[model samples]
Target: MSTFQYLLGICVAVVTFVIVIEMLRRRRLRERHAAWWLVAGALAIVVSVFPQLLDTAAGALGFDVPINLVFFVSLFVLFLVALQHSSELTELEAHNRAIVERLMVLELKLEHQLNEESQ
Candidate 1:
């Protein structure tokens, strides 16, 4: 890689890492959500610092092009993050439904008591 390319990669990776940390500090991103990003950022930094590692990994993994390997890893990480969020959304929906049902039952009982008292 050219010196400019190497420096650019390092800068970008460092920026990503710093952004994740800033988000966490601001409470905009929960630690659970940030975990994957942090991992990705760290990996990016490592790869940026040692570009040869990418070539070696790609060769070992049977990828003809190192860039393709980077693309694949990025997609896989995104897929995992999406799957995790989907799972959490399903759980939250279940909890929300239960809470709504409980609230409805409580409201019914309260209404019944009020009717009896009035009568």
Candidate 2:
């Protein structure tokens, strides 16, 4: 095996190990999410071990030049993360508005009671 291939395999292994550790620590990655990452990592490991897969995939995709698919996949994952954050922000905003409305109603009632007593 060439030194380049050996180095690629080591990098893939290290990334996969770190991902697994993070998923375990967070405990938020459901089976479906884990499955996707596992499949991606496995494919990467396989391709790194056998560099021929890169040529095959490039040919199948009709690209004369080799492209790194990982970049596209990472971008998609980042978009998903942003979407989830937006949804959470929306929910929090709605909850805060409801609380403010309730507080205003209580303040108005208290002021009316005080005025009636003074009169």
Candidate 3:
């Protein structure tokens, strides 16, 4: 990559890392999720500082172009993140259902008690 491109990448990586940290500090993002983003941002900085890492990885993976490998890795990371969020959502939904069922049972019991006390 050219000097300009390297500088730009570094700038972007720094900004992303800062943004992730700021978000975490402000409680805008949960640690469970922000951890992955932080890792990505740190990796971005590392790759920007040592651009040869991409070249080496691409060559090892038999990719003719390094940029394609970057895209592939990014997409794979996003896929895993999406899958994890999907599973978390499923668990949250189950918990919500259980809570609602318990609330309904409690409400019925309370109503029965109130009716008996009135009689």
Candidate 4:
């Protein structure tokens, strides 16, 4: 890889790592969710610093181009992130539904008690 490309990748990776840590520190991002980003940033830094490693792996994997391999790995990482977020959203929806149901039941009970007392 070119020096410029390596430097740029490293810079981005470092920046991302720092931002994720800052967000975690600020309580803006949950630790569980930020784990994936930290891993991605570390991988980016590793891949950027070791171009030869990627080259060898690409050759072994029959990827004709290293950039293509990089793209494939990046896409897979993004897919994992998306999948994780989807799962979290699904869980949140389920929790929300349960809470709403409980609230409605509580409201109905309170209304019934009030009517009985009034009668």
Candidate 5:
């Protein structure tokens, strides 16, 4: 292997090891989040080691060039993340509304009870 390839491989290995260690240390690296990063890292390592994989992926994805495929995939992942954020926001808003409504009902009941006791 060329010196550059060897250095690149070492860098990738170090990064992957560090990430895995971090995940273990945090103890919250659920499978869902880890899987995507693992897949992306693996794909990157594969492409770095075997350039042909990029060409094959590009051909399969019907992209005239390999970089286009990479960019498209990146954009898609970003969109998915945005969608997830929006969904979470909606759920939070709903929860807040429910809490507020419950609080209002409780306040009304307390006022009614107080009036009855006073009378």
Candidate 6:
């Protein structure tokens, strides 16, 4: 990469890292969710600082182009994040269902008691 490209990469990576930290400090992002972002930012910084590392990795992984490897990894990370969200959503739905069922039961008992009291 040219000098300009290197500087741009480093700047972008640093900005991304800083943004993630700022979000964390402001409580906009939870620690658990930020884990992947932090890792990604760190990796980006490392790769930006040492572009050769990405080339070596791409070569080892049989990728003809280093950028292609970056794209693949990014997609993989996104897929994992989506899968994690789906799992959490399923668990939350289960909990919500249980709470709703308990609420209905409680309402029925209260209504029965009110009817008996009136009679």
Backbone clashes under 3 angstroms, per model: 0, 0, 0, 0, 0, 0
Report the lDDT tens digits of candidate 5 across residue range 1-119: 58797678757855875686589669767655565556666666666667677789899979998889878876776677677668868999999999999999999999999999999
TM-score for each model: 0.98, 0.55, 0.92, 0.90, 0.68, 0.96
lDDT of 3 by residue, 1-119 (tens): 79999999999999999999999899998898887788889988999999999899899999999999989878987887898899999999999999999999999999999999999
lDDT of 5 at 74: 66
* Candidate 1 lDDT over residue span 1-119, tens digit each: 79999999999999999999999999999999999999999999999999999999999999999999999999999999999999999999999999999999999999999999999
- lDDT ranking from best candidate downward: 1, 6, 3, 4, 5, 2
**TM-score of candidate 3 to 2 decimals:** 0.92
User: Alpha-carbon error at 112 in model 1, in Å?
Assistant: 0.4
Best by TM-score: 1
Off by over 4 Å in 4: none
lDDT of candidate model 4 versus the reference: 0.91
Q: What digit string (tens of lDDT, one per residue) describes model 2 on residues 1-119? A: 68986787869766995686588579967554465466667766777776777778777876675555545655776677677668878999999999999999999999999999999
Which pairs clash inside model 5?
Answer: none
lDDT values, one for every candidate: 0.99, 0.73, 0.92, 0.91, 0.76, 0.95
Candidate closest to the true structure, highest lDDT: 1
The candidate 5 region of ten consecutive residues with least summed lDDT is 30-39
Counting only residues 3 or more apart in sequence or on different chains, how many pairs clash (N, Cα, C under 3 Å) in candidate 6? 0
Candidate 2 vs candidate 4: the lDDT winner is 4
**Model 1 per-residue lDDT at 49:** 98
Least accurate stretch of 10 residues (summed lDDT) in model 3?
72-81
Q: Candidate 4, after superposition: displacement of residue 4 in Å?
A: 3.2
